[model samples]
Target: MQRVPKAALLGAGALAIVLVVVVVLLVAGGGSDNDNKNAAAPRGGATQKQGNGDQGDAKPDASAKPSLTGSALPNGDLSNTRDMKGPITSGNVKDLQAGWSLALGQESQSQYGSYAASPVVVKGVIYSQDLASNVSAIDLKTGEVLWSQQYASPDQGPNGVNVGGGRVYGATADSAFALDQKTGKEIWSRKLIRNAGEGIDMAPGYHGGLVYVSTVPGNNGKFYGGGTKGILWALDAKSGKKVWSFDTAPTEKWSKKNEDINLGGGLWHTPAFDGSGGMYFGVGNPGPFPGTDDHPWGSSRPGKNLYTNSLVKLDAKTGKLKWYYQVIPHDIYDWDFQNPPILTKVKGRPAVVESGKVGYVVAVDRATGKLLWKRAVGKHNGHDKDPFYASKGQYSKLRLNEEIYPGRLGGVIAPMSTDGKYVFAPVVNNSVTFTGQDKDQATDGQTSTGELVAVDLDTGKIKWKVEFPTPAFGATTVTNDVVFATTFDGVLHAVSAKTGKTLWEQQLPASTNTGVTVHDNTVIAPAGLAAGQGQTPAIVTYTLNGK
Candidate 1:
């Protein structure tokens, strides 16, 4: 997917999950399409906050806040976000009723099932992409398809579109293209990928005049075995010509000489803008991960993987690195810092906040790239230090399977939402155990649970955390008072942003690996994907029934 505005930073989420997961095979062999950023390992569960020296050009604009109409959602470039203060409050959310249902395609026909893209509502039209990367325009009020751009794209998700500069932008398996916003006609297309093992799946971010699209190391629903490096590109929005490109992979000293040991970084979501021509994104993880049998504990890939699993700030016009703060150093467990870099003002200071599968949400000075604060969400098992110990051959079999919090299918696997003061995250707590630091197979403990956490943007302290029965995926959407999240059980939960209490919940027709959109009195939920035996993949829209 691809456009933010004229210039925008990239945005979140990870993993190609199913109704059930066998992570061992997915990690040690053919990477079951899955996924994050790690720079430096924070010594403890949290990092301290600080002021910065770079009083850069970033200015706060509430009007420029990500919304559905006009611009995109705060995180909605293939993920989700919103600007309108939602009307469904904790008190009134219980009155919501199913309003309209739209099916993108049949579960059998699509590989990734139904919709993975968050619906982008601009003006009165809703722009959405399906599992096949098909773009559609619908009437926001009546739920009618206005135009459809047909495609045969693979179900490599988080794929979606960005509507700006009179064109809608999206990508297929190997190419990126632009479409007329009104007529749905193809304008300019660029071939961005050369192989199935590595391609583009994230929604492109747009701002000022350039569009940002990055290459991911995945082949449809599977990951590249090895040697695939990711690239971030700033393309000319008008001609689809590359303005600049940045290599996400850093040149590292291979632990095994002359071996193909590098599987580099990419993006899971679109980027966010810093108002001051700076584009921000959470970089993906490095691979040949955890370790192969011989290269135990990722010994073949050692040291801090610069730019990988880190928050990279770049000059939107030049693509030059401004600053970066790594969350996990030499990440072995796919703890990607892959959430949308949400921009907000804390105590009059501009800050960028992000969260990844590492289950840690971090905030940094927007201009200085200095750590403001960091807090751990969900669960932790100290497995984050395994790569360090094992990388140095201090391997201990006693530590095997002992650490599994934020496991293979766990942590913050979806995009997060923010309403200035607090950030809302959808976290999956599926515990996964590995045979050892040197082993390839990982076993799922199957203790999969979920939570919605509210973190104070300024202090990095968790304000509240609401638990759920099953894992939640996709993006977290919030109005003024209520936070909206979707669970793997296909239930949409409306939680109190202030209290972390579930105010209302509704079950859909099927399971979900997607997000929700809230506009005015309506909450649009994409209840498509992994439909039950009798259910059809449908996008369910709920309206306040009696309010």
Candidate 2:
């Protein structure tokens, strides 16, 4: 697959939140081989007998009936976002097929680029948002085009798509779009700000009856207001009406004028819901803009920016700020804390684990937003001599730059898969560059090479790390015994979840940006260029056969 030419026209904020520090303890645990060995073992004699003589000797339990309809879909209830509901279980595994699986739209050319938004699966239907402010619905099983509807602003970049409450929600560069899930018809559209220049980078998160979206304004192609001021909106899911809005820009006069000061700390990734009415999300970089004196430095700004690069928790129902943990105070390296925050129980403790551009994997208390543990999963590089203050008094110097393992874009960018026993992180290699004066420099460039890692969720210890030949830019999926990942190089790979060994591999025409989704025995990959060039972008489906 070929990389698209750099489009310098518009700004879409970086991905992930700031890197927070956590203390991790290494411990020994069960191995992948041990798990596999037990799975393949024969069942007890009584269970075996029941299976063999099943005919008329046993009656099926009423509660065990196969479900023909989709289970109750998840509402974007902050408290319940982490709870597993419906047919999508965290532990169930299924075989996947791979081909020109599903087609949503004709390839279209645009100035910004092709499509970068990932699609969503809801109740067997696939929902996608493209460059234009529109969302399309397709049949997951048949690849049939169901319907497509356009939102209000065509120029708005619909970066993320989501489905809930029998409604489809899309987050555009300028606003939010809500559509009828069944008809692909627009229900209502709301614009937080008009043509703010910098496109909002996050997908909309739905919880309870509210939709959460973020935006960045005052981006004049310079570094000052070019940085986000951290604007978040909560809207009524059914009506596209604003419920509440929060701003992270500092209220002090001196701080607002310093371009190096925290100007914009907008949301870059979709907020995660805890299913219990709580929401979790991250913020992005501080700015002087792209080319200006607003660069983040000790002398440039005197104090830490509130919520500039931090993990924030909000009441899902009321849009109330609960607690926050700053990952990087007064961030200078363009490290945005906007990655996915996954909620899982680690070592029996309910925790939120997240990755960031700073190359760290951190776990925090989901309810209280308290730090539990953190580890350097990738390489870190930057000025480590800067003095800053945390909740405690003052620290003279901290290690800001350590050539860590994973760079930005995460050791894993996609949401992790877990069986409640282990977490699967798809690894990617990345690099960074810094320029400017010795004290203040502009940083850019991150390259990724892909790999897969299994970690003990409880201890934050690596059970195994397996590298891929090509870098993966898409998402990942897992079932029973296997894990799946697709690369920008137009390839799909299947590996033993237990052994970290490759089970199958297949090549496609273009980069796979949407990741792999499984339906029954087939695997689906959405491949093609966002600009509608080179290889024809189409969905490929695959299935495995007995040798």
Candidate 3:
């Protein structure tokens, strides 16, 4: 289990009031092996217009007025905006009452692995999967299982699911597969990795007639050594045939220190697609986790690590590189630029925005990959320092007291919300220390806190902010007047979109680490995996009752 470092603000004296959650669930203890970002909270039943219909039908009409306000479908598409305009308002969010809750998956020997992947609701049925590779289609209205099916062997379960073209798409550690949207019948499955270590932990992106999948073993355990690689694959959606593949960690002949270094450029989230069919995605950190085993801190895998720690744009039709933006060069802090880049227009110029675990949100020209503007959304005290390590087997070689902010876990792991004009990104402000190899030696030296920052899309300016008790680990969804966010501490806060003021909140039984789904006038989210609780995971739903 990954040890969560304790933290407190260094000097900010309680600058705000602590909001209490009114709706609480009775939850037991459990945890997830993977510390993934939660899905956005369910938006109440609100039907919004689709952007230019589907990408397969035609390109997004450039002249069409963008759907700047109101509720849109949640997680139905993989652009990763996390901003599906919903109908939930600050005025009515308090009226949200629990509807029903149901557990997902088979009984696991260990309770730690819950549904890290968010459930995708299509045609009134919820498509969800467990770590054990069990996929089910449930009735959205009655919270009853409609049809349950497992993605046979070689499938390690999916990190998340996406829907399009009358099919459900997902990827496991070693493969990417599709299922019939109506029946859970196996459509087709393709093996992504033959090697042992590398697997996929991303949701597949489906558009036109193609499916995009990413594979890596970067987060399997600790960075071991070289020989492992990350890859991006594109396939025909109709038939599971390879269209093309790109090696994220391609070999570079210019860097001398590249010898014997394991370069890791894993794509951890769903890739974003733009109006013109351009694909955008972020790369994870290069490894050896601490850099002590390879060529030393900042020295191994020399030179930008090519595509790692970078935002890459690809041609959706041929899987060719269109442009690229490297967020940080030679990263050693495990600050992977793993969040999906959200697409939008700035001043009528097409642009894409992305934020990672570094607390930096950047906007770049969508077609050119040129940096437009970048902003540090929160307190980022971290500066690259020489990673220290003693001889193997010696605890004295470790830097036990070294504090790094925008800590490895700080930054924006959760997805952001947008109002067409502004983007609400969640940031965690905490510092971390490397006590020993995979060992927990010290607690957080400073307080671990976070803030919900609203960024003006045009200029990357801070519009407003609201501090949270803990890091917001789930996606933030928004309507016209309200913005919703969830914390690792189990509280979901609904704040005003215009003023960033807290309007309502509900205390869940366990922390939400997956996106919440609000469709057809109902709100549902995964409320499981309470630390040490070993609780069974379930998808809980709510609606505006007695309205």
Best by TM-score: 1
lDDT of 1: 0.65
Model 2, C-alpha of 79: deviation from truth (Å): 8.8
Candidate structures ordered by TM-score, highest first: 1, 3, 2
**What CA root-mean-square deviation does each model show from the true structure?**
10.5, 12.2, 8.3
lDDT of each: 0.65, 0.49, 0.59
Q: TM per model?
A: 0.85, 0.74, 0.81
Model 3 C-alpha lDDT per residue in residues 1-547, reported as the tens digit of each score = 0112111101100111111110121122234332222232222222221221222222232223234221112332445555544557777877877666675434310122355555666556666665544566666666666555554332222256666676667775577887666665668999987367566666677776888887764333322245566789998886779999988877454154563456567666677776676888887666554454334454545555678778899888888898889877766566667776777777778888888776689999987899999988767664532322211223344354577676655677666767668888877776657554322232333455668899988999999999976666566766657777766665667789899988877666555555465564566676544442554456677677622
lDDT of predicted model 3: 0.59
At residue 320, candidate 2 shows an lDDT of 81
Reference-based TM-score, model 1: 0.85
A best-first ranking of the candidates according to their lDDT comes to 1, 3, 2
Model 2 off-target regions past 4 Å?
A: 1-96, 102-113, 151-158, 217-228, 248-254, 259-262, 289-291, 294-301, 381-412, 437-448, 530-534, 543-547
At residue 373, candidate 3 shows an lDDT of 92
User: Candidate 3: misplaced stretches above 4 Å?
Assistant: 1-78, 105-112, 151-158, 219-225, 252-260, 382-401, 435-447, 532-536
- Runs with alpha carbons beyond 4 Å of true place in candidate 1: 1-19, 22-68, 73-83, 107-110, 251-259, 391-393, 397-399, 436-440
For candidate 3, which ten residues in a row score worst on lDDT? 6-15
